[model samples]
Target: MMLVFALMLCVPAFACLAMAMERHQETLFGALLSAAASRVLRCAGWSALFVALWLAVAGKGWALGLVWYSGCTSLGAGIVYGLLIVFAKRMSAR
Candidate 1:
Protein backbone atom coordinates (compact mmCIF):
# COMPACT_ATOMS: atom_id res chain seq x y z
CA MET A 1 0.00 0.00 0.00
CA MET A 2 0.98 3.66 -0.33
CA LEU A 3 1.47 3.94 3.40
CA VAL A 4 4.13 1.26 3.35
CA PHE A 5 6.12 2.96 0.62
CA ALA A 6 5.77 6.43 2.09
CA LEU A 7 7.04 5.52 5.56
CA MET A 8 9.81 3.29 4.27
CA LEU A 9 11.21 6.12 2.23
CA CYS A 10 10.44 8.83 4.77
CA VAL A 11 12.62 7.24 7.43
CA PRO A 12 15.75 7.04 5.33
CA ALA A 13 15.03 10.35 3.65
CA PHE A 14 14.79 12.21 6.91
CA ALA A 15 18.00 10.69 8.15
CA CYS A 16 19.75 11.51 4.90
CA LEU A 17 18.46 15.06 5.05
CA ALA A 18 19.68 15.55 8.59
CA MET A 19 23.03 13.99 7.79
CA ALA A 20 23.42 16.23 4.77
CA MET A 21 22.68 19.33 6.81
CA GLU A 22 25.29 18.52 9.40
CA ARG A 23 27.72 20.96 7.85
CA HIS A 24 25.45 23.98 8.08
CA GLN A 25 25.97 24.32 11.79
CA GLU A 26 27.73 22.62 14.66
CA THR A 27 25.72 24.09 17.50
CA LEU A 28 23.67 22.08 19.96
CA PHE A 29 20.45 22.93 18.14
CA GLY A 30 21.68 21.46 14.88
CA ALA A 31 22.79 18.26 16.51
CA LEU A 32 19.56 17.94 18.42
CA LEU A 33 17.49 18.62 15.33
CA SER A 34 19.31 16.02 13.31
CA ALA A 35 18.97 13.46 16.06
CA ALA A 36 15.30 14.17 16.45
CA ALA A 37 14.70 13.99 12.74
CA SER A 38 16.47 10.69 12.50
CA ARG A 39 14.40 9.35 15.37
CA VAL A 40 11.18 10.51 13.76
CA LEU A 41 12.01 8.87 10.49
CA ARG A 42 12.96 5.63 12.13
CA CYS A 43 9.79 5.58 14.19
CA ALA A 44 7.66 6.43 11.19
CA GLY A 45 9.06 3.54 9.22
CA TRP A 46 8.63 1.16 12.11
CA SER A 47 5.04 2.22 12.60
CA ALA A 48 4.31 1.74 8.95
CA LEU A 49 5.78 -1.71 8.91
CA PHE A 50 4.16 -2.68 12.16
CA VAL A 51 0.72 -1.55 11.08
CA ALA A 52 1.11 -3.22 7.76
CA LEU A 53 1.85 -6.45 9.57
CA TRP A 54 -1.18 -6.01 11.73
CA LEU A 55 -3.29 -5.44 8.68
CA ALA A 56 -1.95 -8.55 7.07
CA VAL A 57 -2.96 -10.46 10.16
CA ALA A 58 -6.51 -9.12 10.03
CA GLY A 59 -7.16 -11.33 6.99
CA LYS A 60 -9.71 -8.87 5.69
CA GLY A 61 -8.87 -6.62 2.79
CA TRP A 62 -11.50 -4.15 3.91
CA ALA A 63 -10.13 -4.02 7.41
CA LEU A 64 -6.66 -3.48 6.02
CA GLY A 65 -7.81 -0.28 4.39
CA LEU A 66 -7.83 1.48 7.71
CA VAL A 67 -4.82 3.71 8.05
CA TRP A 68 -3.07 3.00 11.31
CA TYR A 69 0.16 4.74 12.02
CA SER A 70 1.76 5.04 15.40
CA GLY A 71 1.79 8.57 16.69
CA CYS A 72 4.87 7.60 18.66
CA THR A 73 6.00 5.19 21.40
CA SER A 74 7.37 2.55 19.10
CA LEU A 75 10.34 0.80 20.71
CA GLY A 76 11.34 -0.69 17.38
CA ALA A 77 11.37 2.74 15.80
CA GLY A 78 13.59 4.14 18.51
CA ILE A 79 16.06 1.31 18.05
CA VAL A 80 16.12 1.64 14.28
CA TYR A 81 16.56 5.39 14.44
CA GLY A 82 19.30 5.14 16.98
CA LEU A 83 21.20 2.79 14.70
CA LEU A 84 20.68 5.15 11.79
CA ILE A 85 22.07 8.06 13.76
CA VAL A 86 25.10 6.05 14.75
CA PHE A 87 25.71 5.00 11.18
CA ALA A 88 25.26 8.54 9.95
CA LYS A 89 27.68 9.84 12.51
CA ARG A 90 30.27 7.32 11.46
CA MET A 91 29.84 8.09 7.80
CA SER A 92 29.98 11.86 8.28
CA ALA A 93 33.31 11.59 10.00
CA ARG A 94 34.84 11.96 6.58
Candidate 2:
Protein backbone atom coordinates (compact mmCIF):
# COMPACT_ATOMS: atom_id res chain seq x y z
CA MET A 1 0.00 0.00 0.00
CA MET A 2 2.71 2.45 0.94
CA LEU A 3 4.69 1.50 -2.12
CA VAL A 4 1.69 2.11 -4.29
CA PHE A 5 1.18 5.53 -2.79
CA ALA A 6 4.82 6.35 -3.29
CA LEU A 7 4.61 5.24 -6.92
CA MET A 8 1.57 7.41 -7.53
CA LEU A 9 3.24 10.46 -6.06
CA CYS A 10 6.45 9.78 -7.92
CA VAL A 11 4.88 9.62 -11.39
CA PRO A 12 3.41 13.10 -11.20
CA ALA A 13 6.48 14.41 -9.47
CA PHE A 14 8.62 13.25 -12.35
CA ALA A 15 6.15 14.64 -14.83
CA CYS A 16 6.32 18.03 -13.17
CA LEU A 17 10.10 17.93 -13.22
CA ALA A 18 10.22 17.01 -16.89
CA MET A 19 7.70 19.57 -17.94
CA ALA A 20 9.65 22.22 -16.09
CA MET A 21 12.27 22.03 -18.79
CA GLU A 22 11.90 24.38 -21.76
CA ARG A 23 12.51 21.56 -24.22
CA HIS A 24 9.83 19.39 -22.70
CA GLN A 25 7.44 22.32 -22.32
CA GLU A 26 6.86 22.62 -26.04
CA THR A 27 6.57 18.88 -26.48
CA LEU A 28 4.11 18.45 -23.65
CA PHE A 29 2.18 21.72 -23.72
CA GLY A 30 2.60 22.66 -27.39
CA ALA A 31 4.27 25.92 -26.34
CA LEU A 32 7.12 27.09 -24.21
CA LEU A 33 6.22 28.18 -20.74
CA SER A 34 7.17 31.53 -19.25
CA ALA A 35 10.19 31.68 -16.97
CA ALA A 36 7.97 32.23 -13.97
CA ALA A 37 5.83 29.20 -14.79
CA SER A 38 8.88 27.05 -15.30
CA ARG A 39 10.24 28.15 -11.96
CA VAL A 40 7.01 27.24 -10.23
CA LEU A 41 6.88 23.83 -11.85
CA ARG A 42 10.47 23.19 -10.92
CA CYS A 43 9.84 24.11 -7.33
CA ALA A 44 6.66 22.07 -7.15
CA GLY A 45 8.37 19.10 -8.70
CA TRP A 46 11.18 19.12 -6.14
CA SER A 47 8.79 19.65 -3.28
CA ALA A 48 6.55 16.78 -4.38
CA LEU A 49 9.54 14.49 -4.74
CA PHE A 50 10.63 15.40 -1.23
CA VAL A 51 7.16 14.69 0.09
CA ALA A 52 7.14 11.33 -1.62
CA LEU A 53 10.46 10.51 -0.03
CA TRP A 54 9.10 11.50 3.35
CA LEU A 55 6.02 9.37 2.85
CA ALA A 56 8.13 6.38 1.94
CA VAL A 57 10.51 6.81 4.83
CA ALA A 58 7.74 7.35 7.32
CA GLY A 59 5.69 4.40 6.16
CA LYS A 60 8.56 1.95 6.12
CA GLY A 61 11.92 1.59 7.81
CA TRP A 62 14.83 3.69 6.52
CA ALA A 63 16.57 1.01 4.45
CA LEU A 64 13.44 -0.41 2.88
CA GLY A 65 11.98 3.03 2.26
CA LEU A 66 15.10 4.22 0.45
CA VAL A 67 14.99 1.15 -1.72
CA TRP A 68 11.36 1.72 -2.53
CA TYR A 69 12.06 5.40 -3.35
CA SER A 70 14.85 4.45 -5.73
CA GLY A 71 12.59 2.05 -7.62
CA CYS A 72 9.75 4.53 -7.68
CA THR A 73 11.97 7.32 -8.98
CA SER A 74 13.40 5.16 -11.75
CA LEU A 75 10.00 3.83 -12.81
CA GLY A 76 8.44 7.25 -12.66
CA ALA A 77 11.19 8.80 -14.76
CA GLY A 78 10.89 6.03 -17.34
CA ILE A 79 7.16 6.50 -17.53
CA VAL A 80 7.55 10.25 -18.05
CA TYR A 81 10.19 9.74 -20.70
CA GLY A 82 7.95 7.32 -22.58
CA LEU A 83 5.05 9.70 -22.50
CA LEU A 84 7.17 12.62 -23.67
CA ILE A 85 8.42 10.66 -26.63
CA VAL A 86 4.94 9.58 -27.56
CA PHE A 87 3.58 13.07 -27.32
CA ALA A 88 6.43 14.53 -29.27
CA LYS A 89 5.96 12.00 -32.04
CA ARG A 90 2.23 12.52 -32.12
CA MET A 91 2.62 16.28 -32.43
CA SER A 92 5.19 15.94 -35.16
CA ALA A 93 2.95 13.58 -37.11
CA ARG A 94 0.21 16.14 -37.25
Candidate 3:
Protein backbone atom coordinates (compact mmCIF):
# COMPACT_ATOMS: atom_id res chain seq x y z
CA MET A 1 0.00 0.00 0.00
CA MET A 2 2.74 2.44 0.91
CA LEU A 3 4.72 1.48 -2.14
CA VAL A 4 1.67 2.10 -4.26
CA PHE A 5 1.30 5.57 -2.83
CA ALA A 6 4.90 6.35 -3.59
CA LEU A 7 4.52 5.10 -7.13
CA MET A 8 1.45 7.27 -7.65
CA LEU A 9 3.30 10.36 -6.54
CA CYS A 10 6.25 9.53 -8.72
CA VAL A 11 4.16 9.28 -11.89
CA PRO A 12 2.84 12.84 -11.69
CA ALA A 13 6.20 14.12 -10.58
CA PHE A 14 7.74 12.75 -13.73
CA ALA A 15 4.89 14.12 -15.78
CA CYS A 16 5.42 17.56 -14.33
CA LEU A 17 9.11 17.28 -14.97
CA ALA A 18 8.47 16.33 -18.57
CA MET A 19 6.09 19.20 -19.11
CA ALA A 20 8.63 21.61 -17.70
CA MET A 21 10.90 21.06 -20.66
CA GLU A 22 10.40 22.90 -23.98
CA ARG A 23 10.33 19.75 -26.11
CA HIS A 24 7.83 17.95 -23.93
CA GLN A 25 5.74 21.09 -23.61
CA GLU A 26 5.42 21.19 -27.39
CA THR A 27 4.67 17.51 -27.61
CA LEU A 28 2.04 17.51 -24.88
CA PHE A 29 0.50 20.97 -24.95
CA GLY A 30 0.94 21.81 -28.64
CA ALA A 31 2.76 25.04 -27.77
CA LEU A 32 5.62 26.33 -25.72
CA LEU A 33 5.02 27.12 -22.08
CA SER A 34 6.04 30.45 -20.64
CA ALA A 35 9.38 30.42 -18.88
CA ALA A 36 7.70 31.05 -15.56
CA ALA A 37 5.37 28.12 -16.03
CA SER A 38 8.24 25.86 -16.86
CA ARG A 39 10.12 26.93 -13.76
CA VAL A 40 7.08 26.35 -11.58
CA LEU A 41 6.54 22.90 -13.02
CA ARG A 42 10.19 22.00 -12.51
CA CYS A 43 10.06 23.06 -8.90
CA ALA A 44 6.79 21.26 -8.25
CA GLY A 45 8.12 18.10 -9.83
CA TRP A 46 11.24 18.05 -7.66
CA SER A 47 9.17 18.80 -4.56
CA ALA A 48 6.76 15.97 -5.30
CA LEU A 49 9.60 13.52 -5.83
CA PHE A 50 11.11 14.49 -2.49
CA VAL A 51 7.75 14.09 -0.78
CA ALA A 52 7.38 10.64 -2.30
CA LEU A 53 10.79 9.65 -1.01
CA TRP A 54 9.87 10.91 2.43
CA LEU A 55 6.63 8.95 2.38
CA ALA A 56 8.46 5.80 1.46
CA VAL A 57 11.12 6.27 4.11
CA ALA A 58 8.59 7.11 6.79
CA GLY A 59 6.27 4.23 5.93
CA LYS A 60 8.94 1.58 5.78
CA GLY A 61 12.38 1.20 7.25
CA TRP A 62 15.27 2.90 5.49
CA ALA A 63 16.59 -0.19 3.75
CA LEU A 64 13.27 -1.44 2.40
CA GLY A 65 11.98 2.03 1.69
CA LEU A 66 15.02 2.90 -0.40
CA VAL A 67 14.59 -0.26 -2.43
CA TRP A 68 10.92 0.43 -3.05
CA TYR A 69 11.69 4.06 -3.92
CA SER A 70 14.11 2.95 -6.59
CA GLY A 71 11.56 0.63 -8.14
CA CYS A 72 8.78 3.21 -8.00
CA THR A 73 10.90 5.90 -9.65
CA SER A 74 11.98 3.56 -12.44
CA LEU A 75 8.42 2.42 -13.14
CA GLY A 76 7.05 5.94 -12.98
CA ALA A 77 9.65 7.34 -15.39
CA GLY A 78 9.05 4.48 -17.83
CA ILE A 79 5.29 5.02 -17.78
CA VAL A 80 5.68 8.74 -18.49
CA TYR A 81 8.16 8.11 -21.28
CA GLY A 82 5.85 5.56 -22.90
CA LEU A 83 2.93 7.94 -22.74
CA LEU A 84 5.02 10.69 -24.29
CA ILE A 85 5.93 8.45 -27.20
CA VAL A 86 2.31 7.49 -27.78
CA PHE A 87 1.15 11.09 -27.69
CA ALA A 88 3.91 12.19 -30.03
CA LYS A 89 3.02 9.47 -32.49
CA ARG A 90 -0.64 10.35 -32.41
CA MET A 91 0.10 14.02 -32.93
CA SER A 92 2.31 13.19 -35.88
CA ALA A 93 -0.38 11.01 -37.41
CA ARG A 94 -2.90 13.80 -37.27
Candidate 4:
Protein backbone atom coordinates (compact mmCIF):
# COMPACT_ATOMS: atom_id res chain seq x y z
CA MET A 1 0.00 0.00 0.00
CA MET A 2 2.82 2.35 0.91
CA LEU A 3 4.59 1.37 -2.30
CA VAL A 4 1.49 2.19 -4.26
CA PHE A 5 1.25 5.55 -2.56
CA ALA A 6 4.91 6.26 -3.24
CA LEU A 7 4.56 5.46 -6.93
CA MET A 8 1.43 7.55 -7.21
CA LEU A 9 3.25 10.44 -5.58
CA CYS A 10 6.07 10.18 -8.08
CA VAL A 11 3.92 10.51 -11.20
CA PRO A 12 3.24 14.24 -11.02
CA ALA A 13 6.66 15.10 -9.68
CA PHE A 14 8.31 13.32 -12.59
CA ALA A 15 5.94 14.86 -15.11
CA CYS A 16 6.48 18.38 -13.82
CA LEU A 17 10.25 18.04 -13.60
CA ALA A 18 10.57 16.39 -17.00
CA MET A 19 8.42 19.01 -18.68
CA ALA A 20 10.25 21.84 -16.95
CA MET A 21 13.63 20.78 -18.35
CA GLU A 22 14.31 21.33 -22.05
CA ARG A 23 16.64 18.38 -22.34
CA HIS A 24 13.99 16.08 -20.91
CA GLN A 25 11.30 17.71 -23.01
CA GLU A 26 13.20 16.94 -26.20
CA THR A 27 14.52 13.56 -25.17
CA LEU A 28 11.42 12.06 -23.65
CA PHE A 29 8.39 13.80 -25.09
CA GLY A 30 9.88 15.28 -28.26
CA ALA A 31 8.33 18.14 -30.24
CA LEU A 32 4.83 17.06 -29.42
CA LEU A 33 5.08 19.00 -26.18
CA SER A 34 6.78 22.11 -27.51
CA ALA A 35 3.71 24.30 -27.15
CA ALA A 36 1.72 24.55 -23.90
CA ALA A 37 4.38 22.57 -22.05
CA SER A 38 4.47 24.95 -19.14
CA ARG A 39 0.70 25.03 -18.91
CA VAL A 40 0.50 21.28 -18.97
CA LEU A 41 3.23 20.92 -16.39
CA ARG A 42 1.56 23.43 -14.11
CA CYS A 43 -1.72 21.61 -14.29
CA ALA A 44 -0.03 18.28 -13.71
CA GLY A 45 1.84 19.58 -10.69
CA TRP A 46 -1.33 20.97 -9.14
CA SER A 47 -3.26 17.84 -9.86
CA ALA A 48 -0.56 15.74 -8.29
CA LEU A 49 -0.58 17.90 -5.18
CA PHE A 50 -4.31 17.55 -4.91
CA VAL A 51 -4.13 13.83 -5.32
CA ALA A 52 -1.47 13.60 -2.64
CA LEU A 53 -3.62 15.63 -0.29
CA TRP A 54 -6.61 13.43 -1.00
CA LEU A 55 -4.63 10.28 -0.44
CA ALA A 56 -3.18 11.57 2.79
CA VAL A 57 -6.57 12.57 4.11
CA ALA A 58 -8.08 9.25 3.19
CA GLY A 59 -5.17 7.24 4.54
CA LYS A 60 -4.59 9.19 7.69
CA GLY A 61 -6.22 12.21 9.34
CA TRP A 62 -6.26 15.94 8.60
CA ALA A 63 -3.17 16.99 10.53
CA LEU A 64 -1.10 13.92 9.78
CA GLY A 65 -2.34 13.90 6.21
CA LEU A 66 -1.06 17.40 5.52
CA VAL A 67 2.30 16.48 6.93
CA TRP A 68 2.42 13.29 4.91
CA TYR A 69 1.45 15.12 1.75
CA SER A 70 4.19 17.68 2.20
CA GLY A 71 6.87 15.13 2.96
CA CYS A 72 5.85 12.85 0.13
CA THR A 73 5.72 15.63 -2.44
CA SER A 74 9.10 16.96 -1.41
CA LEU A 75 10.72 13.54 -1.47
CA GLY A 76 9.11 12.66 -4.77
CA ALA A 77 10.17 15.93 -6.40
CA GLY A 78 13.74 15.50 -5.21
CA ILE A 79 13.88 11.97 -6.57
CA VAL A 80 12.50 13.05 -9.94
CA TYR A 81 14.95 15.94 -10.17
CA GLY A 82 17.86 13.64 -9.42
CA LEU A 83 16.72 11.12 -12.02
CA LEU A 84 16.28 13.86 -14.60
CA ILE A 85 19.79 15.11 -13.99
CA VAL A 86 21.19 11.61 -14.44
CA PHE A 87 19.18 11.04 -17.60
CA ALA A 88 20.20 14.40 -19.07
CA LYS A 89 23.83 13.64 -18.39
CA ARG A 90 23.62 10.25 -20.02
CA MET A 91 21.76 11.59 -23.03
CA SER A 92 24.27 14.40 -23.49
CA ALA A 93 27.16 11.96 -23.31
CA ARG A 94 25.80 9.86 -26.12
Best lDDT goes to which candidate? 3
| CA RMSD of each candidate after superposition | 8.5, 1.1, 0.9, 3.0
lDDT of 1 by residue, 41-92 (tens): 4576455555554543343344433332342224335654686667658767
Top candidate on TM-score is 3
| Winner by lDDT between candidate 4 and candidate 3 | 3
lDDT values, one for every candidate:
0.47, 0.88, 0.92, 0.70
Name the regions of candidate 3 deviating beyond 4 angstroms.
none
Ranking by lDDT: 3, 2, 4, 1
User: What residue pairs are clashing in model 3?
Assistant: none
lDDT of 1: 0.47
TM-scores for all candidates? 0.32, 0.93, 0.95, 0.70
Question: What TM-score does candidate 3 get on C-alpha atoms?
Answer: 0.95
* Alpha carbon lDDT at 59, candidate 2: 81
Which of the predicted structures, 3 or 4, would earn the higher TM-score when compared with the native? 3
* Lowest summed lDDT window (length 10), candidate 2: 1-10
What are the clash counts of all predictions, listed in order? 0, 0, 0, 0
lDDT of 4 at 56: 80
Query: Pairs clashing in candidate 4?
Result: none
> At residue 47, what lDDT does model 3 achieve?
93
Model 4, position 35, has a per-residue lDDT of 54
Model 4: per-residue Cα lDDT at residue 18: 65
